[model samples]
Target: MDGHPLRLALDLLKGTLALTVHKIRYGLASRLWHGTNLVTEQMSRHTQQVRLLRAGEVLGSLDVSTVRDEIGSRRGTVSFNGCLHQLFSGQPLTRQEKALVLAQLVASFSLTTSYDFADSPLLDGDDRLLMREVLYGAGFAAREMRTFIYQSRQDGQDTTADIESKSTREQTRSATRKLEVVDVSLDEFIRFHDANLAQKHNYRRWDIDAAFVADALALGKARILAARGRSADGLTPQGIQAAMIYTWDDISLKLYRISYDTAKTANPHANKVLIARGMQMAHDLGLLLDTDCAPPGAAILYERFGFPERVRTHYVRATLLSKFAAFIRRDFPSLDRRLRPWVIRAVTRVNRSAA
Candidate 1:
């Protein structure tokens, strides 16, 4: 008999024993306290890693990486680390832990990390407090507060029906051709985004890339909606004029991006039709429709289409230098809050200039 066989058998036995012990402990802890701390602490200790913890259990982990397209730009981001809900459990980190996570992120990636936080009633109150304190302590400043909205499948169906009826009337009166909607491949979606939407706005920081869409598509996690139009010669296809990229969860289908041509002569009703179509698709799937983060004006547009404000989210960002300084400097606790208005104005100016 080979000694390797015995060794492998022993290793398998050890692994099985460890897993059994883990499950027993988790079960006991869960029964004892319906809360997560005990189990979460054990999980953190076992992994010896920093992770998003909730109810004392590890909900998820974060990963930081350099933006491939921004390789030379010295920009890095905390890419989508699992689903948004899993990572942001509303659990706040202790100051020391927050400092450690941020320091490690900056040192490892050599760039600041940014993420969005959406408020939910499900989160623990202390968790929300920790979120604010840690981000503020880490010198992470809040960006424009965007409204997140959703509509039920039934409401979506009703809205889509009304929009379709109106679109038909408008098409007949204006003699404007309605763009045909179709499902597009990842490559086609990327081309439309790059040509029509990428350069039109300074959305590099928030825009979804091809790799993300490709991975989602490969995993059967998303749907692509594209609008095909006629070319100037009225013969060849004009490629994608409007597109809506969306994904789903147990409850809702969320629009990730919506792009359309902004030329003056372009059909004014194109976006409305595309949006109505997206709603209809979500309805057919028996899921609520969610519009991603939108500015106040855009929120108004979503409301018109039957999506009402479901939640609000803020994009929080911090620089490595500022985060470090926050750990060292303890004076003027109110300074950041007091200067927030001015900072917002300054950032708005910079963004406008860049655009």
Candidate 2:
């Protein structure tokens, strides 16, 4: 039998009667109201149907009810899925609305990182501009220096780290190429670095990886100072010469440089020595404690510099970086809102943090 309309009407009537009777017996036990036996049975069946069927299925079902209830009875309304669908398409989004969504998606979730400096030479042109900015730092005259990463062993790590990347804004790359990893220090920042000032890269202002490297370099010197300080066994001459050059390289491959003004020079081990010296200096300056790395950024170097007694016996949680993602997403409506503003912020912040 075609019971569709009749079923809906019956369900309606059942709902109306249940609401009316329930009001009169507000505090009474549910069993005390078995008086409206048919209506009560219908309510049970309707509730079961609601539990078993999806919104669309329920609306399409013929077994719901047949009796039409008086107008204005308590009842369920149809569910809407179209709006939810549009939300995920990234077609368009209202800022506050999307912010609300993002907040729910990433509430307290931690994020990890990696970075790149494009994948082609400037001549080849696949995002070649990425080549320029990154190269400018490693070029004959680099202002400051830092490093980047392109996928590495991420197996079971707390905060996988990488520098931010750059893509040539205009033009395209002629062919695919590998990403370049680098080490960088800003030229503007160099002037402020002096014996009197604390390690200038505030952990809060830079990418997490840089902070670790910076922290490692900071803790490295002191332990060494107590034992070797620039003695023969300490930061090999090769590494020392290399450290003389400020660095910035592609995330995929490492970069090392030593040049005098506009003239280019090469001393491969110089960078290694320089990095080692930087670490030793960090310790010498007391910017970081020797026991910091088992927590995972700069501690091991401290021990390597000569603090064997320093055992980070217990694990320490990472609060290392500036916690950028969540902070930016906090006020947004959705965690994944792909609006231009949010996307731009995510892109800029992610690159800065990674870089």
Model 2, position 303, has a per-residue lDDT of 30
Question: How high is the lDDT of residue 349 in model 1?
Answer: 65
Instruction: Compose the digit string of candidate 1's lDDT tens values, residues 1-355.
Output: 1235446345434533433443444343543443323222221111112353345555444433232222112233333221223333334766555433333222222222323344332235554455544444343344334444444435434545443245453542342255766788766766766677655654443333554455456556578887766567767766566788886544456677777777676665566666666666667777656666676777767655545555433434434333323322334447755654665566556546855
- lDDT winner: 1
Q: How many collisions per candidate?
A: 6, 76
Q: Tens digits of per-residue lDDT for model 2 on 1-355?
A: 1235456345434533433443333222321332111111232222111111112121111111111011111122111100011112232535433332222211111122111112211123322233233222221111221112123222332111111111210101111011111243432123222211353333222232233223324432111110111335543522111223222211111122221111133322222233333333333333221221132332332233332332111111111121123332344436526443555555566556755
Worst 10 residues of 2 by lDDT: 77-86
| Candidate 2: segments with Cα more than 4 A from true spot | 1-185, 188-266, 275-340, 343-355
- Candidate 1 — which residues are off by over 4 angstroms? 1-69, 72-83, 86-130, 133-139, 153-177, 197-208, 230-238, 318-355
Where is the poorest 10-residue window by lDDT in model 1? 39-48
Q: Cα RMSD (Å) between model 1 and the true structure?
A: 16.9
Report the alpha-carbon TM-score of model 2 versus the true structure: 0.18
Evaluate candidate 2 by giving its C-alpha RMSD to the native, one decimal.
27.2
* TM-score per candidate, chains pooled: 0.53, 0.18
lDDT of 2: 0.24
